[model samples]
Target: MGQRTTVATTFGSAVRESVGSSLAAVDAELARRYPGDAGTRQPVHTVYVPADVFTAGTVREWGDRALAALDEHAPDAEAFAAVLGLPGELAGPVHERVRAKLEREPVEDLRIDFEDGYGPRPDAEEDAAAARAARLVAEAYADGTAAPYMGVRVKCMEAAVRDRGIRTLDVFLTGLMEAGGLPGGLVLTLPKVSYPEQVVAMARLAGEFETAHGLAEGRIRFEIQIETTQAILGADGRATVARLIDAGAGRVTGLHYGTFDYSAACGVGAAHQAPDHPVADHAKAVMQVAAAGTGVRLSDGSTNVLPVGTTARVHEAWRLHHGLVRRSLARAYYQGWDMHPGHLPTRYAAVYAYYREGLERAAARLVAYTERAGGDVLDEPATARALSGHLLRGLDCGAVGTAEVTGLTGLDRAALERLAGRPAGRGF
Candidate 1:
């Protein structure tokens, strides 16, 4: 959650520019002339938050209950969602209202999270609420731009959460599609993801949903949230993730560490306890390695800390501190989440800053190296070897754009297309 991407000195102005203009176009233009191509498509920066976190705003009272346990032992999250008693279909009319409410809001990115599977009330109301929430989430999604990322957090596979999962899916998806259709990519957040079999089950259900809706195949994808200690241990942990990938069969798009719930399962203490506890850190890295370049995005969990305080100075402090935290994680090559709209700037700033500084220096050096070769072009022998890796790394560091990469490497369209998944850093 606190992981930041690269950051820059002029981040303040950069943020203003990004929000005001066609960021995609501006970015594309910058990448055209650099030493390499700048065809990065995935947001070099993004913010994420579970649905439950949204209901809390910045208040501490809604704090995560399993803070310590999550740090110590990654446990089954769906079980918690079960305990929260969330699922079932809403009465049709009420469903429509919730959907409308969410659609009107200015929110762009939202995770329809099921906080805990525990709570009071075990009846239709809960189902209605779940349905209502999903509908509203869909509406919020509809009102935003096409880029607004959306996800559905179904109940876990535990007996308690299991039954609710299908019902939740059945009820909410209908509303979601009707509202604005699924997001660019529909992310199904799986909790308490213990084994690959659970993923298989989900995939089966996804298949059915696709058939029923007549949607194109493989349009749905999985995002796993590891929560239990049992789920993260030894060979069992590794096998489980591999299995999940197999189960989803190319449908698993990303892996996200669930800090609080994992801590709870391992007997960790306090929600505020550091997310990167030794055990948790190891587990997250493992998942990352397992998922690397499978085209599956790997994400660090959220920082539970609320951005609060009364003064503008204090709020800026919140931003800076979070910027550092997110920046740290971004260093690990993990994209982090932002719980609120205000966090958007932090996400991009860190990313832009990171790529901007590294790229500028690298670009300058690259240009100099080309000159030192006694030529104005990039193809001299000495310059070639020196700049090959630099070009690739520079591209990774966001220094040069796709066009520049192409110019130097002579990589074709397919190569540039591949680079699209990675971000660029012209620091525009």
Candidate 2:
């Protein structure tokens, strides 16, 4: 047998000591700038309702309408799976979960839009609508019918509507405060952000609101909508989205792509302005990289195509939306916007199928990785984290049951969270 060899350090203790303080500063900056994912369940989709048309029953109404659409069109699991080209194995599970989700909590996130969806209105009219939206949202929460997340999308910070947008936001938040404090699920979205200054302004506004309401300093967080070309690439030739995240002051929860607006800003014709367009993909790719370790989520934009008209037309629209959603998921944009009730069925169907089809393989990989059992594919710790996150997301959206995941991987919720490197139950 060969004699054991001793290993020697390459650098002296004095050299490490000399850089320790500087490295500590770098460590602090990294911690501040690259906080990991917020462990809270991110919604699979955000449903937008025009503020003027929103009501306490809006969420349920959307669900019911989507259910009706499924009934009139793809009436069963096999039919739905066929529309989306779902695998045979996933047809039953995905369809059943989609229906159950629609029946139970169809709208994961609801945004009472005061931007493009709601359009401009008289000051008094907008104020009333804002207050009304707040009241209705509060009532929904009180009645246990509110979506898991609910908020409003105020108009842009462009000089034209800046003050009006601020006023509307104030009215809405005030109304929520009056109606038994802000709900835990309260969400806010600032749209058409073209500059980091605007993000800083938003953080300041949130800070002011917190101070005035005697709430925690960072209690009010908002998502920034990247609808302008400037938000993606500043005239300075720098990636502006990254600066926007830093400007958020730890209060930005998400970055939502605006398909039409961004596409138009890029001079793309309206007909070619779709989520899968090369321009759209580039914008989202920038967003994905910018938000990677910032604990900020990314949401893809919606399609204007509606599933109306004849059965064939509806089916065609469903197929298009499902393909777009699945493509977005494959690209790591897990959430998107649904502009109509008709989009809901396809949205859920696509999401459920994506997760269901990959559940077993992900679970098996995770089990192998955790057990240190060599498998066909060698997965690193980072890959193990990704695998666990996939399973967790599957669990979150009802695509896979906790029991099923546990049975497959022998991991409970806590184990999954640990492996995913997220603090259990952390959130906004």
lDDT of 2 by residue, 126-195 (tens): 9999999989889998999999999999987889999999999999999999999999999999999999
Worst 10 residues of 2 by lDDT: 419-428
lDDT of each residue in 1-428, candidate 1, tens digit only: 89888866755877887676867776654443222322332323233444334432311111222122221222233332222221222122222322222233223334656545333346575577666766655654455432235566777777766877777777777767667676563556777887667888888888888898888898777777777654555353344554565567767766777777887677778854445577667777777666644556666665555544443433453455345444444545435555544333234334433443344344444545545543344454444433443445434434346686566445643443333322333211
Candidate 1 lDDT at 379 equals: 52
Runs with alpha carbons beyond 4 Å of true place in candidate 2? 1-7, 426-428
lDDT of 1: 0.52
Report per-prediction Cα RMSD to one decimal: 18.6, 1.9
